[model samples]
Target: MHIIQFEGSSIIPISILTTIASSLVGWIQVKRYSELSASYILTAHEIGVIKEQASYVSSESDFSSFIRDAETAFSREHTQWIARRVANRKPK
Candidate 1:
């Protein structure tokens, strides 16, 4: 009876330790995911703004304004594409 009681008590500490470790790992993963998701959302928003600006520029007939807006939009789109690629890369 004494030996069985001792063994059971030992397992309690191990179980508690494992649970704590797992919880910490889970929290880290959640934090990382949230950060990544937020970054993606921001990039999407920037792209949307650039697209809207380009549309507005196109509606106008000034060649210089049109060229500037188009160039800005193109640069923004390229940056968004790069961000997407980086975000999707597999963790080493």
Candidate 2:
């Protein structure tokens, strides 16, 4: 709607172009930041859960198993976070 407001081939002022450019830049930055923030929150919660699970171990064998499982989980989470970070970068 706003773009179509400039229907005719008239000479549009520079201020409108600047305003549109600024708005688009702000929107893109905010979207990327919010996505990164959400992924961080999710990863933090997952790591917290792993820590709580580790706290419940009672025997040596169980503790060893817990450590192995937690290590794998932590690694998986880290990999996924990295993937998300890489995927979030836009070409434009």
Candidate 3:
């Protein structure tokens, strides 16, 4: 007669748990980076639009308005990036 009992064998379970945790962390980092990149692209596009509009504006006030709008958009994008970075920070 032979009997086999599974005991004190946690390697497989631990390895799987580690893999899942790592994957989740990696996914979060990738998402955060993607969001940051998108924000940058949006800011760049806004700047381009502002430049185009400025070229056609015939008055100083109109040019100033476009510059103000571009600045606001940039500020908003920076804030969003900061928030995402804070949210994605690793727990201690």
Candidate 4:
């Protein structure tokens, strides 16, 4: 659609677009979306492993261990999320 077309001065439009793209990328990094996604993926894998262990839970102790491990995975993820939020809030 070329809504930002500039007649006879193409550099201005290109420069403006570059600046906007850079700013958007910078904002995404500052928000740490990638790190948050990694954390989620790791947590999901840990939970999946625990679920697999559930099938073999034949004793009370085994069930207790599974629960503890599952809770630990959840706590670790929550702790990381809280830490990231706190870090972002700190003055830079």
Query: lDDT winner among the candidates?
Result: 4
State which candidate, 1 or 4, has the greater lDDT. 4
- Candidate 2 on 3-68: residue-level lDDT in tens? 323556776677788899999999999997897798778778877888898778999998998889
Ranking by TM-score: 2, 4, 3, 1
Greater-TM-score candidate between 2 and 3: 2
Instruction: Residues 1-92, candidate 1: write the lDDT tens digits.
Output: 22223643642455666778999999988997787687668767866776676655544466577677667767876786688679879999
- What lDDT score goes with residue 75 in model 3? 85
User: After best superposition, candidate 2 residue 58: deviation in angstroms?
Assistant: 2.1
The per-residue C-alpha lDDT of model 4 at residue 54 equals 92
TM-score of each: 0.51, 0.67, 0.65, 0.66
Model 4 gets an lDDT of 0.84
* 1-92: candidate 3 lDDT, tens digit per residue: 23334587433555566778999999988986787788788888988887787777878888788878878988898788788778769999
Candidate 4's residue-wise lDDT over 1-92, tens digit each?
22464677543456677789999989988778777888899999998998899999999999999899889999998899889888879686
RMSD of 4: 6.1
After superposition, the stretches of candidate 4 with alpha carbons farther than 4 Å from their true spots are: 1-31, 90-92
- Measured with C-alpha atoms, the lDDT of residue 77 in candidate 2 is 72
Cα misplacement distance, residue 48 of candidate 4 (Å): 0.8
TM-score of 2: 0.67
Model 4 is weakest, by summed lDDT over 10 consecutive residues, at 1-10
Better of 2 and 3 by lDDT: 2
Maximum-TM-score candidate:
2
